[model samples]
Target: MTPEEAVTTRASRRSPRPRADAARNRDRIVAAARDVFVEHGTEAPLDEIAKRAGIGNATLYRHFADRRSLLRAVVLLIMCRVADHAERAAAETVDSLTALRRFVHDAVDERVGAVCGLLIDGGGQDSAEVAVQCRRVEATCETLMDRARHAGQIRADIGLRDLVISMSQLARPLPGIEYRDADAHRHLDLLLDGLRVPAPAACGAPGGAEERSVTYTEHAA
Candidate 1:
């Protein structure tokens, strides 16, 4: 090929690269926004997220039209991650109880509770999106519950709807309660215990019987 033609071809290839980079930067911004929102709640400033993502306000606005748009993106991203975690938990874990526990913990501690706070605090402005995300979360929970029930780890009579409602109800930090990982696990242990089927005599003692229950004396502000 002629030198001029070769140069033009290279320039054309390089031109789209910047657009790809811009797209990646937008994704990074959204991811950073999700983390910030989860940590600081939905009221977290967009400027802070842009700074954290190493992007400018204009760049962030260029990708996300408004605060609601950004929040929607964050919610969708979290839902997708939760779904992926669910699929992995279902496929990889040999122990259905373990998978169910992991799924519940991930949803409560890592995703659902966090997002639900944001949505509630946002005054349900994005109720439609929130509903969709909730359904996805419920589906994941159902999958785990089904596996646990089939394995006889969870009580066979427990319905997915009941399990989902229980998880949601338990996800919230009680009034005046200080939320902590250890505390969360303690509560989860109780819930798991309630779900568990009674072991046969040959199985001997049950697991987590000696674990201390978390005291939820305070409500989270």
Candidate 2:
């Protein structure tokens, strides 16, 4: 090829530099949206999210087509984060029970339940990306629960659905209570206790006497 033609070809084929600034803007928007949703549910205004991200409404809409689209993005981000946490907990903890318990604590601590409302109906986004991420999160939960059950750390009847529902309900904020209430953690502890297997009685005998057991009969907000 001629020199001029070769130069033209290289120029045409050269990939543009990575849009680092746009990527940073997208990250900021997602982070701001998550914070807003945690504080005010998914109905929080897009303008507020843009303001929080220090971006304009036009830019926000450019990144996300609409409110539902933005909600889907935030939910996807959260599911990915939770899935990573579950993997880390499973790999790092020595016992399956500890890993399972830590996942619940850390996930709730991350306010995953805050986004559960958005996921109530799949966030109204039918994209393949969302579906795949959801499956990964579900698989992690199943593995954790299976490990715990096999180790006799949790009741055999407990399943992923039960764990998720309980965590979602627990993560919800009470009407008149502050988000950082100590009682909330205590109540969560009670819920976790219910999922555990009962310990063997200190005394053993034929037709043995009743064993003292701690039954969590109620969960108070």
Best-performing candidate as measured by lDDT:
2
Could you say which candidate leads in TM-score? 2
> What is the C-alpha lDDT profile of model 2 across 29-137, one tens digit per residue?
9989988987877888899999999999999998999888888888888877888888887786467776776677777766778666887635635767777777887
Q: Please, what is the TM-score per model?
A: 0.68, 0.78
TM-score of 2: 0.78
RMSD of each: 7.2, 7.4
lDDT of 1 at 36: 87
lDDT of each: 0.69, 0.75
Task: Please list all clashing residue pairs in model 1, or write none if there are none.
Answer: 175-218, 175-219, 176-218, 176-219, 177-218, 177-219
Worst 10 residues of 1 by lDDT: 212-221
Taking the tens digit of each residue's C-alpha lDDT, what string does model 1 give over 1-221?
99999999999987765577898998999889877886677888989999999989999989988887787777777776777667777776457777776666666655555555655555244567656656776777687788778777879888876765666666656667677665665566666777778733322233445422211221111
lDDT of 1 at 17: 54
